[model samples]
Target chain A: MLEKGRISNIQMEFIMVPTIIATGVLSIPSIAGRFARHDMWMTPIIGSVIGFITVFIVWKLHQLYPKMTPIQYSEKILGKVGGKLFSFVIVFFYIHNTGIVIRQYSDFITGNVLKQTPAIIFSITILFVSALAVRGGIEVIARSAVICTTIFMITSLALLLLIKDLELGYMLPLLENGWLPVLKGSFIHNAWFSEFFLLAFIFPFVHHSAKKGLKSGMKTCLYVMLILFYVHFFVLTMLGVSSVNQFYPVYSVVRAIRVFGFFENFEVIITASWVLGNFVKVSVFLYVASLGLAQLFNLSDYRLIVFPLSLLLFLFSFWDIPNVVVLVDYMTKIQPFYFVSVQTVLPLFLLLIALARKKRSDHV
Target chain B: MIGEWSIILLVQVLIWMIVLFEWKNLKKASKANKITFASILILSMILSFAKLEYLPGPITLLHYIFGPWGWFME
Candidate 1:
């Protein structure tokens, strides 16, 4: 088989940044606000536990099997049937997860931007673009993410303009609901932080010679949590408890920007960058799903399945998500456990199995 | 209703065009790949035309299975 591709630690780090941050910056602030209220900013400290554990686990798994994805290496640790079953389940999970990601993107865009353009179009079009990017493979996606992250960061300058609205007093009532709700708020981002498992699919492709990948990956996860923490802080300080009523709090914050009564509607600028970041996010998940499918089926070329997988994704997303009300409900109530089970606990289980087996292939 | 059907027809045409353009390479796909490809393509086409009535949402599925276990998924 031809070498799939390789990406430097920096590119991997860049990819991780948007993949982790894109969802939280859009969806989490409001959800976190609902639970933690003024203490929402404090949730990231607990969120960091998820980030550290996930990245650390994936990194250890990668160290154990240097040249193989979890899909490929599971067969080595467990015998054929068990490994194949594990890979099959996780591959399907990745595919299903990608569908939900696209659904979120479709919901956000259709609800906020297009308004009337039926979500089918956005879902299909974005999935098509992501499929095209995935066809170019990981190097292309990583490089594209680098460019998008640069734009994404620049657009976040809108956050700076929001500083005038900051009120420290808004956070004065912190812990008004006690520490319990703050911990509950952490559960939302905890799932997001464990999404580092998505990177395990690409970990073998990472240029980790200098051990820079682990540091960079951890930093990337830290960056996402910190950014989410800051965004939550920013939103809380500006909108206070009112932010919890918003579907997209960061966008609401950006929409609130009015410098000297001249600069307004800066949200569009942030949306464009955010939408671009989402493209990378969806493409990465799409790539993982397609690549996993191809590998699972023993196909010669992953690209052959990208189109079909993407089409199926659109169909599944449209049929499955129905509306944002249900979507958000699922995210808060159900997705955290679902994600943690597949992304964190399952991988940890595999690691423990490999350890008990005492495989000679492992390296620290 | 005609407009919606026409939209579906146009999208199907566009999908086929891309498939045709990529067919030179896709022709090398194995029987399993071809069958899987064809099945997914047909599924999407059928879904495009379906009225979306009575389709259970993803959460509904999760809720149904997990609800009995006290996992309502809200």
Candidate 2:
């Protein structure tokens, strides 16, 4: 077992913001457009409420068990068997989630950039590299996140360079459909925001004062929300409501970049930045999955599980869903519930139970 | 196109190098643990080559069963 090290609040914040912001930024404008129509920018602001609620639940849980991971405290809250079962479900979900993320990334690359390369090849390559990072443990992962996130932020801003091509008319008639679309968009946004549930697994590992930890995590969530808002807004302005018709509006917007002739096809740069960002994101999930597995089974070494688990993930990525449409449908309609239930609802339930038990015992 | 055989060979050599590096670092890891790790690496290589087409019907069914969670995409 690797010793848990001191990670300042800021470092903890940096670690999470990029992980949440990764591939999601590319898909949001398109996804939000599906429900929010021309009002996609409002989706993120509304969705952030869900993100804030999730952070509060996690913070509350952390408050009860100051330095313990959810995995560590589950047994105490639910009794040993129940806690283990809960931990098992979470571990299972994260492992499956990691594989899908890996698949999504490989599919993206193969579909767009490396057309001739087999997707399994790309998937295995990424899994292999990510496995190496996971083995290095959390500190290395956090440090790399800081570095990659800086680059991600810069490339994200570069999207703004396309402002000359944006049409403000595309954003006209604000809320023309009233609040229905925005509310629906908020549901999708809530699903993405629920990703902050990962902080439950990581917060116990941070070697910061509780107050500082809470502040850093909230700050990180705020930063990511800002980035997501800007990315979705720009994509809508650049491509119009028709942008929703495309699968990856951000990527399309990047492709639309045509400054002075020489700056055409900045999509390559966007792709590079996205790939790196997804790398950190995927690696973090993989790490969480491994850590959860280790804690559940009481394993002494996580490194030993890395290769086999990654191989299983590689295989899982190649399975089922014959084409892209089904994949997109699955992502938009089904994923929100999955993310919100386990990451949001379940954690909130556990936090409430833990708090009540703590209060009862305190009174006694 | 990189020939299928070449990709296989390249992946195998890389796996062998990784095994050698690990072996050097922890000389005392049980032989069984070492063998298990090596076997998994070999299995991954073999699975990598089986091509998407060669997967058996049962395996494909199993794949679908575990694949596709609704919350993954949009």
Candidate 3:
């Protein structure tokens, strides 16, 4: 095996939670609100249903191939040529997704915190940091996640302070436009939630039993859903349907917090938490992409490709995503279907083929 | 323009630094590993010299394939 380090189930949860929510919390509410309006809080609950199904599918795949990642097993399930082609597509999907994730992070920093600095600097710095973590392997990523996620969750709690300013009446007449808008809003989130399929890469390295890892994965999805719901609740109640107008509704709500009419400017706390969250997020994606590539070509080690892949990711962040307008447009329009198909739908197909093949072999 | 040239230069400098830092490990690495490393590095370096923002990259390609589905949100 290319990866020798093993992580416990809880550490896996810590890493995966930030991986999904790090970017989702900032960007999702506004996008969902654009469709769901006052019913935006319902979007994440609906979206997380995909998370549950993805977790079940990934677990079944893991049970069938106890010692392999999706990259390795896809080769066994398909013929050599077909498996190589499919694995390449999967690796490229992650490479592009990770690039976009970095773009999204740098966009937030430039658009919000550091307007004076060029965005590429933030992208380079974060990718460099994440590259170092990826070089250290999954255990290092897991350990840093434990610290980063704790800080992220605590700072996330600061959003609760906005409850006082929220107009409870804003959430009334829920589902007034019916479920179609809410379901439309949930579409983008399903893309994010289906990211649970990333667990396939980590499953072979997890130290605990498959059942425990499965439970933790489900709990992590619930935690992500609740966190999104909480952020949406604040954004919806405070800004109402107007939250859809702001690019970063969660950041706006965080900026509105005041404890004694004098204390405020909590945006820094949330930004710091986002930076920490993005750190773990990028590291996990980088690790998965590099590991998948190593497995694809039958390399002796994945660590060798980490820095080169990071540079490729840097190049990708600049690949036609010139500004926030283009980035958000891509996220809303193309990404939901693109990400869901590659991450969720493809895996479902692979699982079916693998299961059918297994039945044939057993009968023989 | 100086800005564009500088970006290209910066990318080269960054690539060189990575190669330099990993030279020891690269020396010990197998032929396949070395080839993979050099190929990805060269590809990114070549890509960095181009006007990437103008390039019809993966996003544009994905838009072509999945662009129709976007109407659901519209």
Instruction: Output the number of the DockQ-best candidate.
Output: 3
CAPRI grade, predicted model 1: acceptable
Candidate 2 off by > 4 Å: B1-74
Ranked by lDDT, top first: 3, 1, 2
Per-residue error at A320 for model 3, in Å? 1.3
Reference interface contacts recovered per candidate: 0.39, 0.13, 0.81
Q: Check candidate 1 and list the clashing pairs.
A: none
lDDT of 1 by residue, A187-293 (tens): 88887888899878878888762377678878888888778877888888888888999899777788889989997888778888888999889998888888887
Candidate 1's TM-score reads 0.93
Please tell me what DockQ candidate 1 reaches: 0.42
DockQ of each: 0.42, 0.17, 0.74
The C-alpha TM-scores of every prediction are 0.93, 0.86, 0.98
* TM-score-better candidate, 2 vs 3: 3
The superposed Cα distance between candidate 1 and the true structure at residue A347, in angstroms, equals 0.5
lDDT of 3 by residue, B35-69 (tens): 99999999998898788877889988988999988
By how many angstroms RMSD does model 2 differ from the true structure?
Answer: 4.2
Q: What is model 2's interface RMSD?
A: 6.4
Give a tens-digit lDDT track for model 3, residues A261-293. 998888987898889999999999999999999
Clash pairs of candidate 3? none
Please tell me which predicted candidate would have the highest TM-score against the true structure.
Answer: 3
In candidate 2, what are the lDDT values of residues A1-364, reduced to their tens digit? Answer: 3336556666677778878878677566777788888888888888888788888889888878877777888889999999999998888788767866876787788888889988878777778878888888888888888888778778777787787887888888999999988887877878778998888877877876467666776777788789888888788888888988888777787787777888687888878877778878888898888778777777656677676668656655654445566557656766676778889899888988998898899999
